[model samples]
Target: MDGISHITFIVRDLDRMAEFLCKGLGAKEAYDSAGNNYSLSREKFFVLGGIWLAAMEGDPPAERSYQHVAFAVSQSDLPAYQANLQALGVEILAPRGRVQGEGESLYFHDFDNHLFELHAGTLEQRLGRYGMGR
Candidate 1:
């Protein structure tokens, strides 16, 4: 099968989500439905490091969970991301324990309780560290 076509999030506010994506993660706003919904509801599109991310108007999850979408980031960029998110008044989650070689991560939740991760590790590095290398 082909790779992911796009990732969509059900957010309470399209504008807030757009700000979080653009200012917090450096995503560029590709399109805004602007009350014209060709899909389920009002939605906005963004391009994040070549990945298509969509945010739609809807009720978010009632509670937070570990389930989250992770974006690949450089190890050295974690601090910058953390600062940006903090300035946006986003909640930064404490990272779980990790092995030394697995690389670093920064986790946070958007206004609608959608969790996200900026991970510094590559799949190969994580697999090797976990002793599951191919």
Candidate 2:
């Protein structure tokens, strides 16, 4: 495989996550099933910015950590994205300490305790800022 094929999230409320994905992140529903055969559980599929995301009915995580999926976003649009998340009632985490040249981020958690990040810098940019030639 050249890269990530998809990412599946286990969530307490499948429907809530579906709404979060659709309205909060502009993910289009790709499929819906009661878990009859495909995944063997109630699940919702979505396509967000060309990435496939799946949410399956399950227990919310017992805890959360810094491990998260960071999606690329432009610095100019970060504020609007934050506003959208606020309007959607998502939980925003405190900004973590970052290196000067790394980039900026908005960290947040979903209803199921899944952390996500919208990053506003490229890997190359961060490397250069770190004084390492990219």
Candidate 3:
């Protein structure tokens, strides 16, 4: 109830998802079964900048959409992050138009087509820009 406790992503390959989470999202591997004795299914856990993320082996989403989870980032780091993601061969999507003072974002997709965003703005800033007092 305080904040998001964890997020679970159903993916096709556990290793691939782990790689994306680590290399792209800067997540650390907290737990990995490595196909060890598991009860229900293959799964791995990571701490993405302190956010719990679990990837369980399974079929990916049926179709791609704008539905995505965005991580907060610093505006100065955005360019370098874009370059890194480019080097990793992540699919970069055309950025949406942004109003000044709202902040910036980098939108992209994982190899399996799950969309993600790295936003360089705070909730307070956005609310202020939108004329909603924080």
Best by TM-score: 1
lDDT of 2 by residue, 39-133 (tens): 65788889987999988887767899877888898889888888888898998788999988688999999888899999998989888888887
TM-score of 2: 0.92
lDDT agreement with native, every candidate: 0.93, 0.86, 0.86
Predicted structure with the largest lDDT when compared to the true one: 1
For model 1, residues 14-127, the per-residue Cα lDDT tens digits are: 999999999999999999988678999999999998999999999899999999999999989899999999999998888899998998999899999888999999999999
Clashing pairs in 3: none
All candidates: TM-score:
0.97, 0.92, 0.92
- In order, what is each prediction's RMSD in angstroms? 0.8, 1.4, 1.4
Tens digits of per-residue lDDT, candidate 3, 1-134, equal 79999988888988878878888777899998776938367889999878999888878888899999999999998888888788788888899998888889999988777899999998898889989976
Give the poorly placed runs of model 2, Cα more than 4 Å off: none
Local lDDT at 81 for model 2: 83
